[model samples]
Every structure is written in structure tokens, then in C-alpha cells.
Target: MQDQFDLDVFGNYLFIFCGGSRNKYNALHWDGDGFILLYKRLKSGVIQVIQWPRSREDLRMVSQQELRWLLEGLSIEQPKAIKKAKTGYFH
Candidate 1:
């Protein structure tokens, strides 16, 4: 899968990543030739790899749309149910 999407930066090919809150099987759209859309449908497990303690955490399943943010060095920020304690509490 990586072999196909990973393209050179000489304009010869382009690789686009799109992540979203949808299922893993969501087909991503790429405006290119022979650019295959890769997706995986988990039968009985989680689609994204995360920790067990976070397993119960409300995770927004990423799709092709969200994958864009990931490739750009950004991260998916799902609205967490349990908010973390405020920083500078002692201040």
C-alpha cells in the first residue's frame, strides 16, 4: 500500500491523505492517474491503533479527509468526553 501512495516530489506523482470521523473503509479521492485508494475494514477490532486505556476513550475514527491533517504534521483532535485538569493550577 505504501509503495503505491508514496510518490516522488518531482511532480511525477502525488500522494494525498484524507482522514475523517468515518469508518476505515471510506474510499479516499485522489485526482491522479493509477492512484489507488487504500482502505481497511476491521472485522472485529479497532480501525486505528491506540492504547488499551484509551481504548474506551471516545475516538473519532479518521478517514481520508482527516488523513490530510496527519500527513501535514497535524493531529486529529476529537472532542474528549473527560476534560483534562486545567494547567497552571498552582499558579
Candidate 2:
């Protein structure tokens, strides 16, 4: 992101990601005065990597709630839960 994206292009957006399970997340935002970089590491477990939409557009907008979920280590692209059969049989 640092190499591919520039302040001019990404200044209005926020970046969120972790290097992996052992690394902390890096969140970058642009304030009127300057850029604000936030780093957070959980005591245990890792932040969930967001599954971005498969789109042709270069930019996408994320809602505050979705952002909150992302920060909380949850998948913003949760798949719908599937129901099991009514039969009460087990192996």
C-alpha cells in the first residue's frame, strides 16, 4: 500500500491490515493537519483480513459499522448461515 498508493489518492480513505497472525494492524488516516497512523495488537489471536468486493471500481466506501467490525477481528463479508436437516440422527 505504501508503494502503490499515495496520499493524494488515499488521503481521504483509511487503510487497515496486519502483517499476519504475529503482527499488529496498521491503520492510516489523513487529518486536515496531517496523517494519523494507528497501530494495534491483540493479546491473542489476529485481526481478520477483510475480503474486499470483486469489483472493477478502484475505490470503495465502507460504513462505520463495518469498519468497527473489521477492527474487532470479525469478517465484514460473513456468509449466511446454513440450516441443518430436521432429522435428529447422529453418527
Candidate 3:
């Protein structure tokens, strides 16, 4: 992640995952004073796929709730109920 992203170019938030038995998760951010790098590794479980963007040009937007779930070792993608439109013909 450090090699791939720069704060001035990419923005303040970045997340990186190192997959394996010794899985690692990294987050980089810019504080007023300097850069703050956070790292976490699960002792027993692996972090589910963060679903990174498919291409270099593509971007993935994650909600605060989703980010919280990820840090808790939970799946970010979950099924949600679809609201049906109120039954009335459009004039």
C-alpha cells in the first residue's frame, strides 16, 4: 500500500490487506502532524475480502458502517431489503 498510494495523490484514507494465515490489515491516514499507520492481524480468523476496485482507475466507496464491520472481522457485503415502490400509476 505504501508503494501504491500517496496521501497527496490518493487522499486521506487507504486500506490494505495481506492475506494468509498471518493475515494483516493496514490503514494509512494523514494527521495534522504526520502520517498515522495502523496495522492489525487476526490471531484466529482472516479478514473477508474488502472487495478492492477492479482496475487502477476504479474506486470503491465504503460506508462507515461497513468499515466498522470489517474491523470487527465481519463481512462487509450483506443482504438488504429492497423497498418496493408505492403502488400507483404515474400520470
Candidate 4:
């Protein structure tokens, strides 16, 4: 995974999903000193298929709200949602 995505560049949290059944997910996070790995499996439902980038060259960054939408089985692209304003611009 590191070969494809730069773990260090992703700040702290990196979410990975399995291929076959797509029923499992792993979250890797850096907690200052060490790394923490969290795994989760659904007993009943499967997570929605996300439109992930096809190649390593097609990298895209997601916002916190987009991540929340993804975790909630919703598409990350929300047209109706208000865009987050840029910080440090107002007095």
C-alpha cells in the first residue's frame, strides 16, 4: 500500500478496504509515538462501493465531511452541500 500511496503524506489517518467481498476495512493512524491499526467487519451489510481512482497517478484528496459521507455509505461527491470556506482569510 505504501508503494501506491504515500502514507507519510496522508497526515495521520489512512483507510484501506479489502477487494474480494469488500466487507472489511482497516484504518492505520499515527499516534505521535507509534501506529495504531483498527479493523472492522460488518456482520450483515457491506459498505457501498466507492468510485476510487483507477490508477496510482489519479490521486485525490478528500475533506473531513467527504470522509464522513464515505463512512456512512454515501458518495463523497455531494453537489448540494455547501463548500468549506478557506481558513485564515477573514480578519
lDDT of 1 by residue, 1-91 (tens): 2343343433333333333532344344445555456555444433342321222243334555456644433333445434456787575
How many clashes (backbone atoms < 3 Å, residues ≥3 apart in a chain or on different chains) does model 2 have? Answer: 0
Model 2 poorest ten-residue lDDT run: 50-59
Error in Å for residue 87 of model 2: 40
Give the alpha carbon lDDT tens digit for every residue of 1-91 in model 3: 4345322524566555545553567776766677778888877777776565544455566777777867777777756724346898977
lDDT of 3 at 39: 88
Off by over 4 Å in 1: 1-24, 43-77, 81-91
> How do the residues 1-91 of candidate 4 rate in per-residue lDDT, one tens digit apiece?
5667555634665655545676666767777877778777766566665555555676667788877776665567777999888888687
Mind giving the per-residue lDDT tens digits that candidate 2 earns over 5-89? 4335345778664674633688888787888899887777666654443332544666676678677777555566343467977
What C-alpha lDDT does candidate 4 achieve relative to the native structure? 0.66
Clashing pairs in 2: none
Q: Estimate each model's TM-score.
A: 0.24, 0.61, 0.62, 0.61
Give the whole-model CA lDDT for all candidates, comma-separated. 0.41, 0.63, 0.63, 0.66
Model 1, global lDDT: 0.41
Runs off by more than 4 Å, candidate 3 = 1-10, 20-22, 80-91
Which residue runs does candidate 2 get wrong by more than 4 Å? 2-10, 50-59, 79-91
Q: Which stretches of candidate 4 lie over 4 Å from their true place?
A: 6-13, 43-45, 85-91
